[model samples]
Structure formats: structure tokens, C-alpha cells
Target: MLPSDPAAVELVTCGKIEIEGRLVDASNATLFCGISAEGVDAKCVYKPVSGERALWDFPDGTLAGREVASYLLSEAAGLHLVPPTVYRDGPFGPGMVQLWVDTKDGDDLVDVVAPRDVPAGWRRVLRAMDRFGDPAVLTHSDHPDVCLLAALDIVLNNADRKGGHVLHGTDGRVYGVDHGICLHAEPKLRTVLWGWVGERLPDEAVEALRTLRTAVRGPLGSALAEHLTRAELRALQRRLTDLLADPVFPTPSADWRAIPWPAF
Candidate 1:
């Protein structure tokens, strides 16, 4: 939806990856691979079966809708999430391509599994968020950030935020990738960003969130609204309002309480 040349695009296989086998034969409709496109430096592509929702178990417009919203939210959140690339029906089926980012510079919260695994210098990143009793800032399971992501995920109906959906760039930044399940009108938030719960957000961080909340309603929101339904747009606006109302360390939501098992 964000200025793309649908004509110049083509799907090319990436040799013998196990996933490729399932995709080429059509037995496995969803294929994940890395690509370098005209505007995209390097990106992971999610190709779903044309008109098929069985892969992620949602409706057709759901995935694409969410991708657009995520891009909007990233812009709103001051996050460096690359713009989403849409994959439509070619000779093959329906798939999606989007911008890839350097996770290292992107500030990934889930690059390490354990405190010991954290780079000695970056261990503070772990300690900084240890109050919630998790090493990683984000996870497939749930952390503060993951939970926040889930809220967006559920609002969009994104069911793909499972463990594998998150990517840790070599640059030491955690990047959240799969966004096919998104932009629904539901309150289905799921993800892992709570490692910093109770930890006061710095003044700078809080200010950034404020900027995003307002930006979403500006040109960016207007631009993205073109790709979304009226209801979806309203829903996004509502969510932003709700979050902006209370951008302090202690969120008032009842869901802010405890951490799940493995994370604790």
C-alpha cells in the first residue's frame, strides 16, 4: 500500500532450505526467506497461499491489514520498523514482502536467552530490566514489550508472534518480524516487553511515546488510513488514546501484574 511497484516483483527461490522444499511443492504454502529488493536492503518474506488463510488461521485481509498498521505503529512509536511490502497474487499465490532492518541498531530486547549469555557490556541491559525476572526484554512467550505487542497483535488478530516471529539482528537489536496476523478490531494483545515493568520509563522514552501518539493522528495516520477500514482506523486511534492517558512506570491495566512461568 505504501508506494510499491507491483509489476517489477517476482518470487525467486533461495536454494535448498528445508522450508523451501515445502513451499516449492505447494505442500507448505507459507514460505519464509530472505531477499534483497529494490527499496529493501535485505528482508524476510512471508509468502502465504493465494486466498488461503489456513497458514495463519485468519482471514485474507487480516495479515495485510496488520502489516500496514504495524508500519504505522512503528512510525508512531518512533520504532525503526521497516515499511511493509505486500505480496499479492502472482503466477503463484498470495505472499508479503517488507523492509528489513538492522536489529542491532534497532535496539532488540530479546537477543539473549539468559543473563550470562548477554554481552558483558550489555549485561546492564539485562539488569536494567531484571525487576520482572526475565533476561530478555521480549520473547515469544510474554514480557512487557511482548505483552504490549500482543495487544497490538490481538487488535490486529495477528497469531504469528510465536517464538520464531521475533528476529535478533546481528547488530544486537531485537527485531519483531512476522506480522501477518494484525489489525483486527479485537483486543488481542500478545508479546514480550515487560522485562522493564515497574522500572520507570525515562523521561526521554515517555516523551517519545507521546510524540508517536500524536503523530499517528497526523499525516502518517492519514496516509495509512487509506489502507485500512474506518473501524480499524478508529480502533487504532482508541488504543493510542488509552496508552497515552497513562505513560508512566505503572500502567493501570489489570494485566500488568505477574510474569508467566519460564520468564520468571
Candidate 2:
């Protein structure tokens, strides 16, 4: 389910979905479901388009489309950070259905920890005070997968990349989830993955961006047109182009909030 493998795609797209429960903390109606197809089965998340909460800033396609678009772009970028996602009809109506990622037990890639407790090999994004008036630092592991995700976030124009969205999968691959509020035509890159601002892009990231640049110019652009405006597609291209040209993680801008609220 990490990649858009043929089987993973069919499993999520052709499988029958039975809603198991609701993810109560999600802003939208996020259903935890059991998916099964021809003896293949897996857990998945279903988000019906009708359940989307309207936002003034993003007044275009359903959030479900944005998520599918994100998955496509992530694959096109060669990062494979997003899980297999398909936009389809569900019990409640049409929505985005994605294969669930089982996370590593007792493992975390991002956290808000006391400055003294910052782990080795972790990158610190910000230092502040917690709700209890204790010193805290926003940090994430320096794993290549996490770094690639940070790169992808910049191109996706992700409006939300909370700590809880980054997963260290049991499969040993890192994954990012909850991309409903992304791909707007504007620069809305709020995230907890800002730990590498101003750092040189990793060689792998440079290659991935190059791959994404070409994709944005070709098939990827055409497919994204279904979910994004021409303007949004153009914006996405510009982001990739700029990254390739600069080859560095960017510093946050003052014009907008750099990090999402409830960072976790």
C-alpha cells in the first residue's frame, strides 16, 4: 500500500468498504474502514466528499480530490511519501479512500519535546514554551524519508503537515497522511517538517525534484487538471522549478503562518 502498486490500487479501488469507526479528532468525517476484494483485504480510511467542511480560502474542488491529487504528485515526484489513494464512490457517496499504514510501535519521527530531551540526529525547527510554561522544541528525525516529505510538502503547497500526519510505518517506510487541505493556488506551506530550512537539498531530493519537474510538465500536469485549476497547476510547476533551481530547503515566509496549529 506504500506505492500505487497494481494490487494496492485494485485493493482500495475495487474492494468493498465497510465502515468500522470514525476518527473523532479529524476535522472532516474520516472513517476507518475494512476493505476486502477477492480474498485480499486491508484497513483503509474513507473521507466522503459530502463530509468536507468548506473553507473560505479553498473554494474549488472537494478535499477528496486534493488528496488524490497529492498522492499522484507524490508518486510522480518519486518520493512515494503518500499511501495509495483513490477517489471513488463510497457508502456515503464519492470520497477519497486510502490504504491505511500501520505505524511502528513505540517509534516517532516528529515531536515537540523539551530542549534538553531533543534526540540525537534530530533537527530542531522551533523553540518555545509548552502549555505548562515549560521550554519545548519542535523537532523531527533527520531520516531521508522525512526529509523527502518536507520537500514534497513544499511542492504540494500543503496547508497542514502536523506532527501526527507523519508516520513511521511498520514496513520501515515513512508515510505522510491527511492531505485534504493542500494544492491551493497560493503558497500555503504550513508544516511540522520545517526542521531543515535553508539546508542544501539532499542528492536524492534533487533527483526527485528533477523527476517531478518533468512530470509537472507532462502527464502529471494533465492528470492534476482534473482536481486543480490551471492556475493551481501552474503554481505547482513554479514551486518545483524554483526548488530545482535553488536546491535547498526554503526558509519560512512571514506573510503566512509557517506551522500548523496543534502541531501534533
Candidate 3:
């Protein structure tokens, strides 16, 4: 059984989605949907059930809770991230739901434009970076302006980052989805955003960080105090400190050194 928190939102099983027969996905849990949530809709992801043993051996409720937390934190930091649907026990156990994006087609910047070609979509991505300008805008990567959030994700130990994780909507804006791995306290940062290292954090991004840092010390921090432990909250403050101290390419700590080995 997964850990129970009265705060967790109870999600009823809306229905079941069968993927390849061996595995079944439950989409009725909430507003979120996985890639296989519908036949031929690629925007969804296969959200793992709360107690099901599968790819990652993380504790139950860990993924769902962190996704929610990551969304809230990213919002506070002024970064784009996937928000998860709150889930509690249903017929099958605790489960979180999320909207899916079709990663196979339009969302992929890789196939449409070659690395040599930073197409309009990717150019806009770069532009969004300039617009947000919040150095505290952590993702997963660590190389300054490159994959700023990606570096942040690496620090937070985010798993499940695929080419499709980033989506370019018809509105011409880029949105990130899937933040199941975060707030680990330990260093688990991993991502693929080292393309532009050594650049300065956008001015606006810095201001956003400053705002969040201050907020965390006040009402916002007090509100979160209920959701997170003192240690986890301190780690967040420390991350902000690290970013401010070295806004240009902040590196992970030595004790938490060593990237995960190649998938071979």
C-alpha cells in the first residue's frame, strides 16, 4: 500500500485503457491522460500506478506528490512545467493523471529541424528563455543558459525526460510536461540542456528568483511548510543561493557527483 496523506486528492477510476495487453493504463483517475490514453493520440504519457512495480523502484506516492510539488515550485520560480492531477486510492491504488502530448509528431524539435538548423520553433524556444529571464528558473541542466531547467531537473533527480517532454503548441509557445522526479533533497539532476553554457541568466529570470526566494521566507514558505520538511525546504533555499552565487553555469556538488551510467 502507498503512503496515505489526507491532503492527497482522492481520484476515482473513470475507466481503464489497455496498452499492448500486458499493461493497462487508468485514465479516468483525473484530468491528465497518457499517450495511450486514446487510440492514436500521442500527447499522453503512461503514468505508472501507485503501487505497481515497473521501471523505477521509487516509493509509492513519491512520483505523484513530487509532480504536484514540482509544478507548484516551477510556478513559483516562473518556469514552465507539467502539472499532475492529485490522486488517492481508487479500485487499483494511488494514481496521478496528467495531460499527454503527442511526442511522435509536431512536439519533436529534433526531426523537423536538424541540429544545424535552429528552426522557427526552436528560435522561439530561445526567445522564451530571454523573456522569462529568471535565473532561479531551474529545470534540469546545469550549464547556465543552455538547458536551464534541464540542469535543474538533473539536480532534482528527474527521470522520464524524453524528446517529447517539451511541446511546441499551435499557439507557438513551448510548454514542458512531466515533472515526476523532483525535490529529492539529494542531488539527482539529469537532462540534455548543456547547449549554451556560460551565458548570463536573463534579467527577468533573476528577478523572479529573487521574488520567490523572498516569498519562500514569508507567506509562501509558511504555506509550503505544511507540505515539505524543513530539510527539503532548506535545500530549495540553498539551490537559490547556489544560482545567485554562480549564475553562470552552477555545477552539482562533489558528494553527489557521478552522472548515471550510459543506458547501454
Full ranking by lDDT: 2, 1, 3
Candidates 1 and 3 compared: the better one by TM-score is 3
lDDT of each: 0.46, 0.89, 0.46
Better-scoring candidate (TM-score), 2 or 3: 2
- Residues 95-207, candidate 3: write the lDDT tens digits: 54444432234334322222344543232112112234532212222222335455445334554444445555443334455566556565555433433346666665666
**Which candidate number would show the highest TM-score if scored against the true structure?**
2
lDDT of 3 at 234: 86
Worst 10 residues of 3 by lDDT: 1-10
lDDT of 2 by residue, 128-209 (tens): 9989999999999999899989988888899999999999988788999999899888889999998888899889888988
Clashes of each: 31, 0, 37
User: Which has the higher lDDT value, candidate number 1 or candidate number 3?
Assistant: 1
